[model samples]
Target chain A: MDLKTLTIVVVVASFILYIAIAIWAKARSTGDFYVAGKGVHPIANGMATAADWMSAASFISLAGIISFAGYDSSVYLMGWTGGYVLLALLLAPYLRKFGKFTVPEFIGDRYYSKTAKVVAVICLIIISFTYVAGQMRGVGIVFSRFLEVEILTGLIIGMGIVFFYAVLGGMKGITYTQVAQYCVLIFAYMVPAIFISVQITGNPIPQLAFGSNLAGQDISLLAKLDEIVTMLGFNAFTAGSKSTTDLLFITAALMVGTAGLPHVIVRFFTVPKVSDARKSAGWALLFIAILYTTAPAVGSLARLNLINTIQPGEVGAVDGNLKYSDKPSWFATWEKTGLLTFDDKNGDGRIQYYNDKNESFKAKADSYGWKGNELKVDRDIMVLANPEIAQLPNWVIALIAAGGIAAALSTAAGLLLVISSSISHDLVKGIIAPEISEKKELFIGRVSAAVAILIAGYLGANPPGFVAQVVALAFGLAASSLFPAILLGIFNKRVNKTGAVAGMIVGIVFTLSYIIYFKFMHLELNNADNWWFGISPEGIGSLGMIFNFVVALVVSKVTEEPPQEIQDLVESIRIPKEV
Target chain B: MSSKENREAYWKANLKLMGLLLSIWFIVSYVLGIVLVDQLNTIQFGGFKLGFWIAQQGSMYVYLILIFVYAKKMNTLDKKYGVED
Candidate 1:
């Protein structure tokens, strides 16, 4: 069969498998629907969390972002995976010992206030919605590129799949399906990486190849990449251009936010015991690290391959650039998707791919008769186009398409579950109608899930802004608001309901206004110079988290202490054994 | 010791363990990976600059180890305190 036919078969097979699992493990009660009956084995929960955590951002855009930004993107590499350490050490076991169905439940009970639960529910809703939007966009990208469908059509199809499982199986169904997705995505990611590693560095392991010499060449890969990119006026591949302070703050914000995310924290609730929670976090990070470690290698290798393909000879030489007619089949293929475009600025009928915006490079470019950079490549296309660029087999290309969809759908389903549970369990049942029956609550959960999918699908069709930037905002919100409240609730017994509530309000409000004023209201002034303390909007959450810590401490000191029962509750969660 | 005294001692030990482990965690990723990156980059490690390798690869490995070690140590502490489930 041809590539298109084969891609359809693989993608369809995966979908059918997921639907079957959803049916077989369909939720029977609110217990199963919300927390998988709290019976998930540690290892299974770990695999599911890995799939739920590595969204379209990690599978599709991350390598591309790393490739273009070079060493400056280490913030993502370390920031994302390092958060698991915080989750494992600081949060997971205690939350599991609390044995709650949702993150907001713990906050409400610990703070002894209905208002605190409501505040947490709102934060969860905002963070999950912002996050789910990015996943929908990922689904659209995969569908449009591989399945040759319109973005809206792709999103509708994605919504249909998520609605069926998420509405029916709830957390139980999502968990099993996610386990399958983790297998599919990791296989799809590694196969191409291994092939490319062998092709470029004669090494089977991409991580080893990252630092090793190119095949039959004496110079190491990073050194060669640095040489080529610098010659083209781009920053060195192994050196960072971002200030150290910005990197520090950005990395910390991402770490804290990852730990604070409701979707991630809820996964720990599915485990059977407190010890299992810590063990599963370890397993989840190990599985996630498999992909995280390989990403930088894939990024650098892809960058090196792209530059060699574009400029086959000396950088400044007139005959060096590839002729338009001689461009590779992959170039033509990606160009049709409107993601990769070429412009003959000098009408030279050849490609010039360089940093033309570099002031120092402009004089040399003029001397070479090059009008400007003639190629524009979107960063999101790097991983999706990698197999084609490397001339890998057609099957590998098909696998990547399925893998991208799986990553996006898995995370989207997880977020939708969180959003739905927040509305049905936290809002309607916890506050609005405390006397509701379990059966009625389960029905509400399913309906809300379906509605959330529809809303998420609509947003996917009409994305609010750049997917990465929106995702950063989601993390910042989670870090500033939920993380501090949840951390204080468990770690500090002195923080009263009023203190916790005030801290969350101050943290989220301050962070949101700062982001809006800089990012949306004053777009033209959203640079490093205009930022407070040289911190970008992306890194502002770290400072907000600090503010939350300070406000909670001071406010609690000035007010009455938390009741004795609340202190007992805090002491109870700190231990592994149930009293 | 009374049950309350046992609980307090276990909590104190847990705090001590966390402080030590968290210190290592901070030093690996934040100190070596970011703060001292420029100075460490002068030292090469096979195919990588020492700092870049630590940031992208070494810190992650250390993070994995830190979690497992904490878990193992906590398990022992729980058993010793007669709190194992």
Candidate 2:
């Protein structure tokens, strides 16, 4: 079957599967809606968490980032996975024992202040909304490409599917559906990767294939890639152009941010026991690692393949250049999407995929009788275009399309769930009308989810930046604000209401302002001229988190400790068997 | 048994294990991946520098193992303190 037909079939099948799970797992009570009835098996929860955690950023853009960013990009791999360790060790188990339905619920009770709960609700909404918008955009892109639909139309359909299941099943439906999604997405991701790995290195495991010697080469795959790229005036595949300090701060920020994300942290609350939360985190990481470990390999191999295709046969010479007519089927396919474009500005028949903008490289290309740069490859196309580059079977390509959609939709549903619950349960019921019946609350939750989906879909239609960049912003906000507040509330019993509230406000304000100033307001200033203390807006959020920690400590010391009843609540949450 | 003594023992053992695991975590990620990476680059594994391997793959594998090990150890501790679920 053709790509369009296959994509439609896969999407329809997934929709039906999601609806089936939602109906089967329809939440009966507030408890079922919030925590999946707190009976999810550890491994099952792990799979769901993996699906939830991977997001559109992981499935679609991580490889793309690594593909271009080269060795410095290892920070993403380390930072993302390492954060799970912090989550598992520092936060997950205790939150599980806290036995709360929502993150705000935990904060409000622990801090003995409704104001703290409200602040957390605001932060959760902001973080989850920022994240969900990216997922919706991801779905739209996949739909536009594979299903031959307008981007907005694709987003609406994705929104509808997310709405149906998420509204009906809540966390219960989302959990089970995420299990199915994890299976589809992981299989979709790895099949193309494995095929490419075997084709390039005669190895099935991408992680090993990355390091193995290329067929008919003396050097390893990375060394070969490095040689070709540098020959073409690109950076080496295994070395980075970013400063070590910048890399360290960026990686640290991402790690802290991952541990702080509300959607990911809330997954721990679904498990039955504190120990299960701990175990579930491990299982989740193992599942994530399956893709994370393979991704760099995929990125490196794709970079090599791209360079080799554009410059076939020889190194840095006119005779080695790939003729426009000789471009592969994959090149033509991506070119149609405008993600891969070529313009022979000098009217040469050959395609020059080099950094012609580099003054030194331009001089060399001129001397070599090369035209202007021919290939304008969009980094976003790397993973989606990989299977085609390797000339893999049509089914693998179809699976990739399906997998990308699944990854996006699964995360969209999870984030939408959080947004809806915060509005319906936390704001409306918990604060507005605590006496509302379960049925009424469920009705409100469904409506809120549908509305949230519509708003998210609209924002996604006109994304401000790349999906991963937007996700990073969301993570930074969460790390600096919500994560710190939640952690302090549980672990530091002396953090009174005033302290928690002050800390969250300060952290969120600092991080958000830094991002807005750098990303939106500082266009006139060179990057080197703007950022304070060499901390780019991306990494400055870590400083915000530190500020939060200090302010909370100092404020709590000056203020009275939480009341006796709140102290008992803290002690109870720390104990394993009590809840 | 007094709840105070039981809670103290449970938390003490848990904190002790956390300290040990956290130290390993720091060593693998910061020590191997960053601080000592240059020194360890001379040591090779397959085709990768040893420090690079730790930065990319080894630390993640260790983190996964750490969680399971911590869980198992904590479970045993929970039982010892009569706090097992």
Candidate 3:
């Protein structure tokens, strides 16, 4: 089959499979709707958690970010996966033992303050909304690009799929569907990676091929990549470009944020026992690691392949670059998206894709009669275009579309669940209508989920940034606001209601303001040099978390201690118990 | 069910285990990947600068091991305290 037909078939098939799962696993009660009846096996929950955790950022854009950013992209690689350790060891089992329906319920009960619960709900909405927007955006892009539909049309379709499963089956449906999604996405991701690895390095294991010497060459792949990128006035692939402080804090922020994310944490609540929660996290990371380890290989190899495509021969040679007229079909395909562009500067028919901003390369470029770099390749296209760049078969290209949609829809459904439950469970039932019936609660949950998806679809149509950057902000906010509070709630028993509320406000406000100032209000101050203490805006959340910790500790010391019942609540959550 | 003293002991053991595992987590990802990256990069291993490998690949492997270890240790602890629900 041709590319377009195969893409439509695979994507439609996956959606049909998900809808079937939703029908089969429809929730019958509040228990099933909230926690999948707490019967999910550890391994199955692990797979679901993996699918829940690996969003569009993980499936579509992580490798692309790594492909272009080179060594600095380790912030994403380590930061994202390492958080599983925190979840398994520090948070997951305890939260599972708490047996709450939502994160705010735990905060409310543990702090013994409705005010604290309300604050937690607000933070959860903001973080989840920011994250869901990126997933919705990914859905729109994959549909528009693969199916030749408008972005809004794609978004509405994506929202409809989410509403079907999420509103009907809740966590029960999402769990089984996510297990299916994890299989589809991981298969889709690894197949192309293995093929490309064999194509480039004469090895099938992408991880090993990353370290292996290029075929028919003595130099290592990283060494060759370093040499070529440096020649084009870019940093070596082996060396990171961001300042050290920023890298440290950025990685830390992402790690802590991953542990703190409500969507991922709630996955643990679906499992049967506390021990199951602990083991399930390990399984989830193992699954996630399969993709994580393979990503860097896919990244560096794609970088090498792209350069080889652009410059068919030696780098500095006059006749080395591929002529514009001889460009491949893949190049033309991406050019239609405006993501890849070629201008014939100096009237040269060949494409020159070097760093035009490099001062020293200017003279050499002028000597070669080259005016400026004439090709603009968007980083996002790296992964989307990788299979074609390597000449992989049509079926594999179609699988990439299926995988991206699975990833986006799974995560969006998860986040929207969190949003809806926060409203129906935490807001409506917990606060506004404490006397509401179970059926009414379910009705509110379904209604809120539908409403949330519509808002998310609108945001997806107009994302502030690409999938990964928007996710980075969500992580930063979660790190600053939620992680600190939850960690203290579990580890330290003395944190009072006033202290927790004060700490959360300080964290969310400080992190949000710093991010906004640099990201939107004053873009000039967003870089490493201008950053406070050499920590970029992306890394500033660690500082905000620290401020929250210090402020909470000081305030708790001066104020009245938490009530005895709240202390017992903390102690109860620490140990495993039967429901 | 366990006595107050047994429960306290179990919680303490959990804290101690978490502290040790988290320390390893911090040293590998934060220390090896960042603060000591330049120093470690001087030593090459398996076609990678030590720091770069630790940052991208090595730290993730360690994280995986840490979770499994924590889970296994917690299981035994749960059994010891009769808290394996």
Candidate 4:
């Protein structure tokens, strides 16, 4: 079948599947809505968490970033996965033992102050909204590309699907649907990766394929990719050029941020027991690792394939590589999306894809009668364009499109649910109207979810930058603010309301202001001119987290300990037997 | 020690297990992946360098194993401490 027809079929099938799950898992009570009735099997919850955790960034952009940025991008892989260790070890079991419906609930009760809860709610909103915006944009991109619809149209359709399920099923329906999404997305991701790996390295496992020798070549895949990219003026694929300190801070920020994210932490609350929460985190990581391990392989193989396809022979051939006239159909198709663009800078009909940034390489291109870099490859296109790059079956390509949309939509739905719940349940019911009825609260939740979707859709329609970069900002904010506060609130009984609230405010303000100043406001002076302590805005959040820890500790020491009742609450949360 | 003191000793051992695991957590990623990466790079694994491996893949695999290890060991500790859940 044609790609368009196959894409439409996949979309319709996925939509039907989602609606069915939502209807089947329709939440009956506030408990069902908030914590999936707290009966989710560990493995099932693991699968759902993987789907929720992967999001559009993991499914679509992670491999792409690695493929292009090479070793400098290792920060993303380590940071994201490392956070799960923190979650499993430090936070999950205790949070589960706390037996709370939401993260804010744990904070409020632990700190013995509604003010702490309010700060947490605000942090949650900012972090989740920042996160949801990226997911919404990812949904729009996938929809527009595969379904041949306008970006806004795709976003609206995405919103409608999320609204139908999230409004009806809440976390319960979302969890089941996420399981289905996990299957689709992982299958979609692996099939193309496996095909490419086998094609390149005669290996099926992407992780091993990366280290294994390339087909018809004695060199390993990474070795070959390193040789090729460096030959083209790019740094060796396995070597990092970024400052070690910066990379360290970014990795730290991402790890803490992952632990701090409200959506992920809240997932632990869905399990039935404290031990199950601990086990579920391990299971979730195991599931996530399936994709994470494969990601580097995909990145390396795709980078190799991309270089090979564009160059099509040994570099510096006198007769020149294949003409632009002979470029693959995939190239033309992606070019239409503006993700892959080509300009015959020298007015020669041949395309030269190389590092225009490297002076030495630029000299070689000039010596070889090549013009300025002819290929302008956007990183986002790498995953979307993978199937076509491998010349895979049309259905696999269609499946990838569907999978990408599933990844984006599933995460957007999850984020929207959390945002709506924080507003309707935490802020409105818990604080504003403590006497609100369950029915009224449920109504507010549904309406707020729909409205949140609209706002996310608007942001996605006009995204600020790369999806992953925007997500990094979200992670930075969460790491500095929510993670520290939550960690202290759970583990340190002396972390009174003053400490918790002050920590969150200071952390978020420091991180957000650093980002705004460096990334937006101070850029007019040039990037090199502005940063504080030589820390880029991307890594400054780690400094903010440090500040948060210090302030929280100092404030806690100065302030009275939390009331005895709150101290007992903390002790109860720490002991699994109580729950 | 009295039987009550023996029970307290068991609890202390469990806490000690947690302390050890937590220390490993800080050391492996923070110390190896970040602080000692350059020094570790003096060592090699396969064709790749050790620091690169830790930053890219090694730490993650270790993290996975650490959780299972923590869980398994903690289960034994829980039983000893009469705190199994």
Candidate 5:
């Protein structure tokens, strides 16, 4: 009937569907719970992987960043998508052949040391916790807006949903629920994008519309966008500002981290065969690419629409700006979240969203009776605000809410499973209680999942909230610690326990110190001037990974090499077939 | 070659293919998109800028291709070495 009603129906329907799948496919054994009995189809596993991989960041925040930051945001699209190549070819098949349940198990056995296993579990916990916090934040944002509930209320509901499925079904239930999530999120994302594209460029395909001319204009959409943004003192929409050094390192870090993430790599273990693992990666990216390609379109088109809406005519003309009183209802809706604010500094009752920091634009602003830029737009609001900006149906707005929630919940459930399994399977069963029964192990896994949800939810809702940028920290941690260790363990047999363990420790310490130094300890130094060789904290992980490689190599040479059996273990994982 | 020799050869070939694929992957996203973005920006492909397009959309498409291509070629390598699984 109305926007709120449709939103409830869609969101409720999806939640019921996910809970039903969780109940129907609830795990009966540890194998069933952890790896879906290792019987998932390559394609189904691929879809599930897509859902798990596309977190709130991918489904919701990415387009918003791309829309506002323009070409600077391409790092996310290319860096994340390209990592699957490494995973499918370098890691997935071998890990599947190794036949392990958890990433740390592979690390422990491959390194032939219990200490290695313990180290990996620690890293897994930290990385997964950092990641799950972002997911919780995503859930909070979606709930606070779409359902018109407090963020805490939304987070509690989200935690409850995840607890039911993740604690009950483990990876098995999470997988099926994720498949449904992918369908809902992808549909919700694309339908509005297609509508907006057509409204602006008369092209049904957003990707095609991105390249096509505007509906009544001869200039291409991107070119027009470039012209408009630069006129307002922002960087050209098609050109980017990240330094070559920073871009190189950031992209490298993100790619390695994506491959190293435990939640994603674990998905490969669900498929049946080594070949299927390989195929599954291909399928996962194919589905992921659909969203990745469309994001840039939604971003740029939405940016153009927002700019035009705010500055309706000539850029510099005072009369061109929309009267603050005449602004659209969505502006007010988002303003209530405190994400979009208007100061009307000159008290002219008009909004100006130009780059006030530009030196040259200061002269123009003074002449135009503008005290300063009067509007503050949060980068996180673009995707959620797109439907309203495009004047799309209210149902589309509701779907975006559901889509954001679905993305966050699926990713949270997946990460919770990783954390739980690492605790129950690796820590408790592998070390503390080797004689525990399967039934007991399964129960422990469920309890661990529930507990993790509570902790993650609390962290997500509390003050000093983990912003979206901390996701980069999670990636950095994974890149610096797990990726180098895992890749070296598989690709280089000479890496002994001493070396692998030393490398990970060194990597984590170095990366975290650099990140913390710039990010927190010296917040004023969080810029290119203070960065080592102009490498941002996000990109420092690549340097940390190099430290790991070098340290491991040096340590291994000075210490006793891996045992003959460990060498053979490496050789086994390297090969795809049985001896 | 002996059976062990054949397996070694298969593994070598796999490594070599992987090296080639990964290098291309590196060149496309890193070199073209970041290192040589300015030079490539001089060139245009219809409505898309060459470097920006490669960075955002093009590299992703190639990444998809690279994985599938590696899988197909590896399957043949596996079968030839009698290690299809």
Candidate 6:
């Protein structure tokens, strides 16, 4: 069968499976809708959490980003995975013991203020929305590419699948569906990586193969990659280009942000017990590590393959580069998507994929009669086009398409659930209509989920140009605001409503302003030289988090202590078993 | 000890374990992975630079182990404190 047909069949079959699970696990009460009735087994919840955590970007863009950024991209891998440690050790168990339906609920009760809950809800909405818009766009892209449909049609189909499961089955449905999604996505991701690893390094294990020598060559893969990239005027593939301070701060920000994300933290609330929450976090990280370990291997292998395909011979030889007219079929396939482009600078009729921005390389390039770099490839295409570039079977390609969709849909469902629950549970039931029936609250939850889906779909369909940049802001906001607030609420009982609220406001505002000043308002001055303490905007959240910790501590010390019950509440959450 | 004092001791023990484990976490990802990366890159580990491997692969593996270790140790702590659920 053709790749397109195979992709549609696989994707549609997965959707059917999700819808079936939703029907089987349909939520009946507010508890089921918000927290899956708190009966999810640790392993199952871990798998579901893994699916919810690995978004479309993780599936499609991360390997590509790693390939291009080289050592610099370690921030993402370490930052993202390291956060789970924080979650497991510091956050998950206590939050589970708190027995809350939403993050804001804990903040509200712990801080003993309705206003604090409102503040948290607003932060959750902002972070989740900023993150979800990108997922929708990812779903639309996968659909358009594989199903040969317009992006709009693809988005509607994606939205419909999410709506069926999320609105009807709620958290219960999302959990089971996400477990299946984890299976599909991990399998799809690994198959091509295994094949490519075996092909290049004569090894089946991608993680080990990454450090091994090429199949017939004496030099190691990393060594060869370093040599090649440096020869092309790029930084050595295994060397750090960014300042160490920046890497440390960025990694810290991502770790803190991951632990703080409402969608991820809520998954812990679904587990049966406090111990289960800790165990489930471990399981989630293990599952996530399967992909994380393999990603660098895939990245290195893909970069090597890309360079070999483009520049088949010596780097500077006149007859080195592949003739543009003789470019491979995979190149043409990607070019049709407008993600890969070629310009015949100096009318060479050959592709030169190199660092044209390197001033020193300019002299040599001019010597070779090369006016400039003649090829431009989007980073996202690296993962999408890897199977094709490796000449893998049609089924493998089809599986990749399905995997991307599964990733996008699972994460999108998780985010939408959090958004809806914050509205219906926290806003409507907790504050607006405190006396509402459980059935009415469930109905309101469904309605809000449906509305949230529509808004997400619209944003996905007409994604703003800044959607990509805004995602980092989501992590920054979560790290600076929610994480510190939650951590202090649990660990430091003296942090009253005033201190916590002031800390959150200060952290969020500081992080937001710094990111905006560099990323948006003053883009021209975003260089390292002008940055504060050599910390880029991407890494500034760690600073904001520190500021939050300091301000909260000082403010709490100066003010009255929390009420006796609130202190008791803190003491209760710390114990694994109830008194 | 009174029940409240027992709970306080249990919480203190839990915090101590977290402190030790979190210290390792800090050293691996930040200290070795970033602060000492360049110095360690001069040394080779198998086919990878020592620091680069730590940054990209080793630290993540360590994080995986730390979580499981924390879980197991906490299980023991819970049992010792008569707080197992």
- Identify the leading candidate in terms of DockQ: 6
Give lDDT tens digits, candidate 4, residues A109-128. Answer: 78778898888888898889
lDDT tens per residue, model 3, A1-579 = 888998999999999999999999999987788889999999999999999999987888888889889889999999899989989988899999998789999888888889999999999999999899988988998899989999999998999999999999999999999999999999999999999988888889998898888888898888889898888877788787788888889998988899999999999999999999999999999999999999999999999999989988776688888899999999999999998999998776899988888898888777777788999988877789899999999999999999999988999999999999999999999999899999999999889998999999888987765445657788889998888888899989999989999999999899999988888788876776677899887888889999989988889989999989888888888889632
Please give the lDDT score at residue A280 for candidate 4: 89
Off by over 4 Å in 2: A357-362, A464-469
Per-residue error for A498 in candidate 3, Å, reads 0.6
lDDT string, candidate 6, A1-579, tens digits: 888888889988988899999999999988999999999999999999999999999999999999999899999999999999999999999999999899999999999999899999999999999999999999999999888899999999999999999999999999999999999999999999999999999999999999999999999999999999888888889886898888889999999999999999999999999999999999999999999999999999999999999889998999899999988899999899999999998787899888989998889878878888889989888889999999999999999999999999999999999999999999999999999988999999999999999999999989888899998889889999999999999999889998998898899999999999999999999999999999998889999999988888898889999999999999999998854
| lDDT score for candidate 5 against the true structure | 0.90
Q: Looking at candidate 2, what TM-score does chain B attain?
A: 0.94
The residue-level lDDT of candidate 5 at B65 comes to 94
| Runs in model 6 lying further than 4 Å from the true structure | none
Interface RMSD (one decimal) of model 6: 0.8
Q: Using DockQ as the measure, what is the rank order of every candidate, best first?
A: 6, 5, 1, 3, 2, 4
Question: Candidate 6: fnat, from 0 to 1?
Answer: 0.80
Per-residue lDDT of A27 in model 3: 95
Of candidate 2 chain B, the 10-residue stretch with the lowest lDDT total is B29-38
Per-candidate clash tally = 0, 0, 0, 0, 0, 0
Candidates 1 and 2 compared: the better one by TM-score is 1
Candidate 4 off by > 4 Å: A464-469, A524-529, B1-15, B34-44
Q: Which model, 5 or 6, shows the larger DockQ?
A: 6
Give the runs in model 3 whose Cα sits over 4 Å from its true position. Answer: A464-469
Number of the top candidate by lDDT? 6
Poorest lDDT segment (10 consecutive residues) of candidate 2 chain A: A522-531
Measured against the true structure, the TM-scores of the candidates, in listed sequence, are 0.99, 0.97, 0.98, 0.95, 0.98, 0.99
Positional deviation of A18 in candidate 5, in angstroms? 0.5
